[model samples]
Target chain A: MLHSVALKTLHDQRRSLVGWVVAVVLLVLMYAAIWPSIRDQPSMSDFLDQMPEAFRSLFATAGADMSTPVGYIQIELMSFMGPTLLILYAVGQGSSAVAGEEDRHTLDLLLGSPVSRARVVLEKAGAMVLGTLGLAVATGAALVLVGRLFDLSLPAGRTAAAMLHLALLGLVFGALALAVGAATGSPGRSRGVAAAVAVLAYLVNGLGGLVDWLRPFQRLSPFYQYAAHDPLRAGVSWPAVVVAVLTVAVLVAAAVWGFGRRDVRG
Target chain B: MSSAPVERDDAIRAEAVIETHGLSKSFGHAVALRDLDLTLARGEVFGYLGPNGAGKTTTLRLLMGLLRPTRGSARVCGYDVWHESTSVRRHVGFLPGEPALYPTLTGLQHVDYLSHLRGADPYPRALVLAERLDLDLDTPSRDLSKGNRQKLAVVLALMPQTRVLVLDEPTSGLDPLAQQELHTLMREHVDGGGTVLLSSHVLGEVQRVADRVGLLRKGRLVAVDRLDALRARSLHHVHATFDAPVPVAAFAGIDGVRELSVVDHTLTCAAPEASLDRIVKALGQFPLRDLTCTEAELEETFLAYYGRGEDDAA
Candidate 1:
């Protein structure tokens, strides 16, 4: 706890991280338990096909081949639930990094020392990145390990690639929240803005296939950089990774700039 | 032995460790601090006295770089306050008005974190301060009493042992004994060549430790004087009961006489220590049957400059 800012931040979130890891494991376990029955029924694929085109596109990024492990995992985990959990976790951590400290009035204690404002923001961003990536890796490992019990042998390399994209996706939103919180010094406002932007970005990605006008802008959403290339089926997209990483870098820089130029609230 | 006088002369002529040149701050239309010009030498405690919302906190924040100044500039240990705030903060140990700690962190953890940020070892001096303040270092901040939390904050601010300490209402929540200990610590810090600028609403608290005092009223520094000089200028109550009635005009004409009242055979008035001789000579003109003179407390001295109006500030 007395170490550098990044280490201290991770230390502070240790208990919450454990809880999140447990939740991710349980969620994967539930999906694994249901997979065998769905694979044997064959009618589950028909049910997915019968759904409205918009609903079908919203839920499934790849083709709705529920019989195969990769397609099922893509439809069930990659498109929505996985991103939602990771993004929520990232956004929460980022928003709380600066504004939450100020809200608790402990910022004076930390800032009173010789630590520069920019360093605090940058180190907190480093913590968010590490935590988000660690959670993504856990989610991926859980998916592959639990899927084995249900005869769903997903490729380890493809799963790692997908998790990589997912982690970067989470980082984008996390950095946005961090920037907002640093600029405004209000945790609630920061969370609200980040959530709103995420919802808008999510809608653009989910409805992009059905809505013609939303098609071009879909590529602009962080979700597009995450799942549009179908990292689960076609492992790793360098362009998407570069874009997401660049987005996170710019946002973190903005956070530092925003925090540096303003009066910190007590 | 002869070098002692040379060092004393140099100390007298030493550049002020804390200097603010016409520093000012305002939030929109509301002025928090205006045209503050102050200087503090090493080995001195300068008490900042003001009611709430008189820009005491704002001034401290500006000095800390938490809030940038709107006009002019300030320097702590020769570093610019706004542009070079990190440097200024390197030398200044600040205790905020309401010192909030991490609720889950224990006192020792808080000290460790702060000292580590300053890149100093944690235990030696912190343990000493904790023992002196009677604080339980193992207790989490949320569990600590208000005074205990204050004690922990005090330890953090003083542990670094920086060149300057800017404390905002440092003794607000302390018990009398702890307050005394804090005052003693401030004196010791100043004696060790550290400058202190402490703010307080209670004149008695400042009077105990400050060599010089600055009074703030409505965003302006109205008075700055040596504590001894201020005390010398402090008003004294003079009450005389003569056998014959004294003329109201006799004492009314005296310098520094305020609130003068001469009714019937009794004359009661407040006059500065300097005006005591003239007031007494006026009383001597008539045979005085009874005479009583007592020095008023500095609280009254503060009130004389600042009326009893809380609504005017804050």
Candidate 2:
């Protein structure tokens, strides 16, 4: 069938992909447009320093600076907004992969083909991965390209590393959504599970710095791997990337395994 | 001439394309299907008849491996429906009741994608089916009429010419003209040594092409017989207007009488072949003003068997 499932999935997502890309470009431009003004204000750095320690630890990464381009992007985009956009897109695709089809009563038509269940799950997951990665590249290109126009320059290698970690963070939750969707053919419920777990993981990673008891489990959170080492500053962390990649791989395998064993909702 | 019928019967028995052994499915305590042991052979159309929610859809989905059985097993083309579903699907074409299609895709795109998924180019066959069914291949499914959508579903399912056709209420949204065309297609499918399992609550939908019929009720198969055999015992509507008011007791104990009522001077009821003479005799005892005896709809005959009760077919 020439990877028909994957190709068809991507074809179905063409419009949504464009919308997400355009949103990314516009968002990057807005941030880049504001970088010049923020850099010109020396008093902005004092305002951040005077903020409560808990607020700084939760929202601002280590070595917070309002004047520097990398720190500004890290505190503003990398800390929250970037991951939110990517995770939303990934979770959307993930939910629609299997459970959303079932919810729409189209799973029967798709599975009516001679393809195996494992192949369907794997191909849909592949399509989601490709869509997420493509969006990540667009975001990176937009950040670098848009940054130049506003006199805000960022290190190329570190920006790429940040984009890589952000993509992995998105993939982790996307795969989780896919696994939950495959196990239970309920789109709303699967998305809810993924979003709730993501919020909890974000809280654990962010609040872990100030909350003593949460420290041991903070590394287990995907957000920690995404930003605890701050890829925008120190560049890529091989160990964190491996952990994020492995989490996605395991979740995809679980999707195949769960889907193979259950009865597909008609 | 007698040997011809025997050879056809032998041909049917020679190939059991669809066989189920004590297949059962349940969603918790609510049993959707129970111990379904049905066999469909090549060169025949078996009409699976039932009212809505009679587990007709459940059986069809099970045969397609869309729903796994809670107990027992089924095989299509000698392939296990659940364990070897991919192999089973390669040989079967299924049209679910109210078949869903991608809202944005055109009929041709569906044909292209589904046929490609089957790993075969059935585009030519699909084009011919679409033409014969008078379906617009360029219209998006969401924009098409219900009848047109159903026609597209038929085109997609029938394109492959698979060994077995599992159709659920295939004619629900079709016009009489399209229904006739679909029936003809089904006949041709069997004539070419393929098997068709056609499910419908209305017996007329499948009677024109079905050689045999199976009635399902509350997830249980209540009756399975040749279409003609069921027709032989088919219920007949007996309506009579008497000159005088007739008591209900006059026809209280006649066998096979259903929907029986003697309201004042009018007596209206249905009875099968065996009870017709008794009903006629009972009418004679009263001075009859008018009498009308006609064959009931095939569905009425079927309902006379299992349609009465608190209908919770789901």
Candidate that scores best on DockQ: 1
lDDT of 2 by residue, B109-170 (tens): 99989988887664589999999999999999999999999999999899988878999999
Candidate 2, B-chain TM: 0.82
Give the winner by TM-score.
1
* Model 2: residue B180 alpha-carbon error in angstroms: 0.6
lDDT of 1: 0.87
Q: Stretches of candidate 2 above 4 Å error?
A: A1-3, B1-14, B237-291, B303-314
Off by over 4 Å in 1: B1-14, B302-314
The local lDDT score (0 to 100) that residue B287 gets in candidate 2 is 94
Candidate 1's residue-wise lDDT over A1-266, tens digit each?
66677887898888899999999989988888888887898998999889998887778885878898888888888888999999999999999999988888888988887788998999999999999999999999999998898788899999999999999998899999999999999999989999999999989988987799999998999999998888988889999999999999999999999999888765
